[model samples]
Target: MDQAETKEWSRRYAGKRLLRSEILLDDPLFQQLINTSYFTPVPSIVRNYFQTQCQRCGNQKRSLFGSIPCYSCGNVHVYCRKCIDMGRVMTCTPLYEWTGPEMDWPHHSNACTWSGELTEPQRKGADCIVQAIQHREKELLVWAVCGAGKTEMLIPGITEALRHGQRICLATPRADVVQELLPRLQQAFAKLEIQALYGGSRDREATAQFIIATTHQMMRFKHAFDTVIIDEVDAFPYTNDPSLPFAARRAIKPEGTTIYLTATPRQQHQMQIASKKLPHVFVPLRFHGHPLPVPEYRMCYTMKKDLATYRPPKAFLKWYHRRKHPERQLLLFVPSIRLAEGLSEQLSDILHDCVIQAVHASDKGREQKVQQFRNREFDLLVTTTILERGVTFPAVDVAVLAANHTVFDEAALVQIAGRAGRSPNDPEGEVLFFHDGKTEAMGAAVRSIKRMNKRGGFR
Candidate 1:
């Protein structure tokens, strides 16, 4: 290949392993490049005497592999079913990557353009992050409370990484979080080239030095990033799924720094911190310098019964009428999609003057509905646990209809209650948990909030 052709194609293939079929360039050019010494071809799936492994997603589960008749190789091919949604990775398939010289990333003098100042706690955490990145630490956990301006604290560290010409990725577990973080990061570093990758993002074809992508998208990259910041490290499916962590580990360089940001850490992480095995930074206070609103427990024996009868619970209605701030918006959380859709209609009918909407994970217009609620086009929003984290409504009273349900784990409950009291102007917005009976998760969530408040110096 010519010098210009080699440089342009190498930029696209660097640190990324893709199937030969995925390259969209002319066949002659692709063949020419693949024939050169700069390209390395690897088998997509490796099989040994005992086990099989998928190089893309790092999936080794024997149960997730299936055999299919192949036309290209004329043999029975085994493919990984776990990450088949991204693409079918079969034994016969090969992944091509550029093993050539690294591209020169642009350097910015003032990478961060955010005008807001960080709080004391935030600055401490930011300093810790900068130190970890500069030292190239293997791992660092940022244990901060919800609404503690976790994103703002990363600006300094990210600015440092950019100035040093290091490629960076801020990966989260969910697509919604990816969508929400893109605009904020873009606005903060308006002069830099940034790309946000999700299932349906239009920027998939564009290459950028900075990337914001879902953890699932990380499967497509191998040894790509210098700094990988995992936002909402406690959120699902990241917490439950093994492949996502494996993908994240494979996506970053061997010596890359991995920073985990979370409000509620898992028990394993907590133990590691307590044992002084894991290095961490703690930020107890929020950006507003107010304690998190501890949720009040109310007995709603008729919560499920009222939903069964197509009506709102008496306790919920009573709380709604109390009017601590009736003009503020309401975020009502439920356990399932059925409850979210049912309660929105019943509550809208009872309160005729205000607009109401319901959203769940499966809803195609979930993003649009959330945007409308953020714009104050709707007064009440009924949702499932999908909105329990990574979203902020400045002034809203939060409630959970069946807070004792099995789906409302400790982490979920803490994140749900954190939806309220986010804005400094309305720092004391209320939160309520209406339940048939108290659960261990509920009690733990309450205790966790109180402990955080105590650390914030609130009596």
Candidate 2:
């Protein structure tokens, strides 16, 4: 390879597997890379690859990876629709991985200079992670409460992984978390470069020893990390779709291991622990050693219908006017994006000196709005469940406007209640589940919170 060409390829596509069809401009150079020993080709489409599982995402369902007409290649091609959003993969499409030295595992350093301490329970969880990584254990689940210093619990394990020269990737379901975790990890592991990957991300150039990325971005990787830690394993995007776990699995080396961290997990998570599919650590206490806030259920039988008339139920309005004060911030969780906006407008007119805004997936100014809310520039935030998981505000109270909706499942309800009483300065706060009628999910969520409190012996 020519010196200039080698430098260019090493800098840009060193660790990437790119589709030949996806590369329109650098065809000649890429071909030269293949002609040399720097790049190698792999079949884009495989037959019953992975025992009828989609090799890319491990989808074994015959329906998902079924055949589709490929007008691009003038033939029928079995392409994985599950991961089609990443790129098109057909019978004729060819994928290439860099076989160059630049893509080597230790291509970056393993040195780190972090010296943070973990809480006792956190240290126990952290030690379990180190064991899982050292032994290459297939699965490990950390069931820590929302404010249980779960992120801090990861430090000792991360340090151990780096000491043994293991490459690590922390994958989360939300981009907001990716943004949040990166800085903290970077600050802690001062000697290592950590790259954060998300949609429209700008940190593609760094060959990081530690990579913090969204589960969606994991699809672009193959056999990459030695230890893959999936934080908030049961959160959105991953919860809404089944393919993300497969992607996280696919990104790990054959001898690598996975660690799942979550406050609210499904029954299947419990099943995995029981069936010996995954070793587990349960930490019911937060770092502050305080009990999780239990929700207070208030019934508003006409709320679902009253929103259309832009008239909130008399019961709710009365409670809001009485309980909500200017000194305290509030997070109002509505089920739908449309409802969040409508509720925000209605609340603005009703409340005085309260600057309220709504945020959701399609909201272009979502990040900005969240920052403004965090800075105390806004008195309240009306949001969909998108904000249900990774957001925290000091002494903020939470209210679920229509908690009886099908969207408020047991796990969702638990996570929503978790939004309140997170900051230690405000160890206790209000969590209201305003429902039209009680459902099993709401009852279960309340019981679960009380159970945890009893376990902690917090009155």
Q: Considering every candidate listed, which one attains the maximal lDDT?
A: 1
Backbone clashes counted, model 2: 0
lDDT of 2 by residue, 214-270 (tens): 888876677777899998878777876776877777788888889999987778887
Q: How many clashes in each candidate?
A: 0, 0
Please identify model 1 stretches exceeding 4 Å from their true place.
1-4, 25-35
In candidate 1, the residue pairs with backbone N, CA or C atoms under 3 Å apart (3 or more residues apart, or in different chains) clash, namely none
Could you give candidate 1's per-residue lDDT for residues 29-49 as a string of tens digits? Answer: 666666765677899999999
RMSD of 2: 3.8
- In candidate 2, which residue ranges exceed 4 Å CA deviation? 1-16, 21-40, 47-85, 98-112, 324-326, 457-459
Quote the positional error of residue 423 for candidate 2 in Å.
Answer: 1.3
